[model samples]
Target: MLGADFYMPTRVFFGENALQRGKEMLLKAGHHAFIVTGKSSAKKCGALDEVTTLLQEGGIPFTVFDGVTENPPLLTCFEAGAKAAACGADFVIGIGGGSPLDAAKAIAAFAANQGMAPMDIYDDAKRLCPTLPLFAIPTTAGTGSEVNPYSVLTLEGGMKKKTFKAPDSWPRAAFVDPRYAYTLPHGATVSCALDAFAHALESYLSPKSTVFSQTAAVFAAREIWDVLSAMPGEFDVEMRTRLALAATVAGMAISVTGTGFPHPLGYSLTLLDGVPHGRACAAFAADYITYNEKSDEGRALIAAFAAAIGTKPNVMKAFLPGVAEVDFSFTEAEIAERIELVAGAGNYQNSPYVISKEEMYAIYRAHFLKK
Candidate 1:
């Protein structure tokens, strides 16, 4: 009796030269394009060059906003949106990892609805104005922002990261050329893979998971884990392709179930402790899986996930420490305060079981304090 409504509208073009499709999508979406990206990776990976060449060849006017940072701040979106509005750009092209892609969605919203306050990006109760059409070109294999409507924004003066989704915020198209990932650093590749795997793992264990979402999650978990386990060696084009596809599939899965504890609780570590977004989220994933598996209700779900990935339930734990470590130092009171934040998160209640404050604290302790 699996029942869930799934919404995925992004037209994905995945292959070695898939980016050539961006020219047509951009042309169809708008006359002028606003390209959003981070400072380095997009430029380093050659995605920027390829995309720009396509736009140029297509005779489409465009502008590049490369101010997006890791854990992108709301100000950056506001700034880029204002720029886009001023330039009369009709569409957005997000060309990087999750940060840029997420920021691009927010930028499109802000750009189109120039009259709305910046904080209104989080007003889920209000019907938001439609965003400019967006096209994503992912240079990294994680966060899956390319295919989802969620845009995770880090507010400058806020305690936790926030996300907003307008129906039109889903990217109109995505160019997932795994060859773009060939230039990724080893550590970044591993971290992104872990992030992708966490998405699959968390969503698969969600109480709201449907058969379709679970299938996508399981496939993503296996694909990400297998490629990640063989890293430090040069990645052939096929391996990179599979890894990128894994992240995208994971993103699609989470779009249906949303995320659970790891993502909500991981925000503090990422924002406050300067942990990488993927690594921070993954730090808590293993314990959460164990927590779920030990419960009567979650045992079947855990077994299903293990079978899908072709491994024991705890195999992820063995791989996690190799990807990222919990090295933060926090006092008991500070730890309690962080736990309170997790308790207040919207997605905290999305866990398969009701998470008591004590249990939440224990999960954090298992990852950080004990390590």
Candidate 2:
């Protein structure tokens, strides 16, 4: 009894010269655009230039806000929103990786609802305004922030990350030009790919997963595995394109099923230990698979995933360690504290089986506790 429930409204333009090919769709977002991005990736990747050229050619005015940082803060979104509103921007364009893309969603929300408090973005029940139309141009093959409605932001004065999700937050269009990622550094490329892999793996294993999402997840996971297994070699344009598509597919999968334990469990490592988001999430991937293997259905699912990626389950688990390098150690108390922080995460409920605090502590101990 295969069933599916999928909803993806963003029009995606993927492959070489995607931005140029999709320029007409991009221009339809709004006449006045508020471009949101981090400090450098957009310019380095040439996405900014291409977007500006397109906007200029279309006679659409735009304002660029390049202040977004890694694990973007709530205050940053609020500030950028104020700037966008001040400029009378009618739409928002997000350029760069997940950070800027996520920030753009918040900026759109804030810009649309002037004077809304920073925390108000998280409270959908209290929100009374619609978000500005959003367009995404991804400079990296990670986060797939271009397609999803989730905007993960750091709380003020804290390392904790929270997601702001609304139906209106989805980008109206996504330009996924693989050429934009050609300038990405080697480490970033690997990290981004790993993040996509985690998304697919988690989504496939989620209890909420449907036939549609599982099919997407398996395809994305297979594509990512192919790219990752060929690492330490040249990532030519073809390889980048495959990875980019995989990331986008993974994002679409998670949009339906949401992520499992790895995402929430990885947040502390990313924020506190300075591990890259993708690598941090992947650090727990093997263990997450193992944890689920405790159940019969879970074992079947893992086998299915392994078969889809053309590898044995154990072999796939072994391959993760080479890429997800988490060297830091934590005291038993610290491990317990970290587990406590994420114990209440909604992702746990999405898991195939109940995840007790004790089980979480054990997983943390296996990875982070001092021997």
Candidate 3:
């Protein structure tokens, strides 16, 4: 049994009217707020305007620092942190998609210090100081960044992305509302949904899973799968609740257990090919189980998860447009090139089973067929 220690410090306000309580939350935290956003869309969506009016009415001195990008970069984080400090923002608010929310976490940490950020994330142990108070306002129902403890950032000229975390990495509070994601683009919608699914699958199968984490992941997975199974529908409160809850639960699971090889491999697809995080992983779901779940118990658990989502045990068979075989079409040279990079990831060591580059390539080719 993985006698894991778990604790979530973020004060979460859930459901439909949660955003209405933002100003009250500000007063509780004691602050001048710095709002972090991805772009002008938050302003166009009137979300920025709405949050501003609320903070102003409550007399919370606030400023907006809006330049976060998809797959947030270290420079973006440093720039945002500088802006927050320059504005004297005592409390930080992230009011866009997961990128802004993740940016907020790093910005909060970096803002508390007064020095150049570490050029190498692996070497930047001193860059992450104790963070200022953070409020995560998730505009999208995926990535679950609002409720998690780690931030995934793209390093400058780095071959691989870096995951940042410490005891102080958790958000101080999270304000999640489904209404904000009602207008998400179709591709974004698919990508985010896929990201949530990876969280569930990874959390569920981790040898680090505890009874508490597994219970939470199972329910979250069910809800996320239901929402994805029936797409292009109006936002269901239940789905939003599940996404928020799943993100939080998965976040907790990762805090203790961490993730496996698919995540590192998925990064390659996202960075190199620009496949969104979630979809890239989904493309490999069937293969992930095949290569990693060598145990009968593991396969049974995966089959159960698929059945829960209305898919069969052999769901992976559908991914192959032609015949199924161990041989993949990717050049062996290409697979050999990334073998060490994927294997070297810290998270890959956390996987229950030992994985090699050949297995990783097999998993990738299995899901990437052009069918």
- What is the lDDT, from 0 to 100, of the residue 15 in candidate 2? 89
Among all candidates shown, the one with the greatest lDDT: 2
Tens digit of lDDT per residue, candidate 2, span 18-67?
88888887777777999998989899889999999999999999999999
For model 3, residues 251-298, the per-residue Cα lDDT tens digits are 555555667666787677677666677766665566667755686767
lDDT tens digits, residue span 1-371, model 1: 78766779999998878877545666777789999999988989899988788888878899999999888888889888999999999999999999999999999999988877778787754435688889999999988989899999887775667788888899998899998899998777877888898899888888788888988998999987777766646767777889999999999999888888888788878777787878888787777777776678677888877787878767776667557766776777778878876577777666666577788887777655622
Clashes of 3: 1
lDDT of each: 0.83, 0.88, 0.69
RMSD of each: 1.9, 1.2, 3.8
Shift of residue 216 alpha carbon in model 2, Å: 0.7
Report clash pairs, candidate 3.
195-278
TM-score, per-candidate, Cα-based: 0.94, 0.97, 0.87
**lDDT accuracy of residue 358 in candidate 3:** 66
Clash totals for all candidate models: 0, 0, 1
1 or 2, which is superior by TM-score?
2
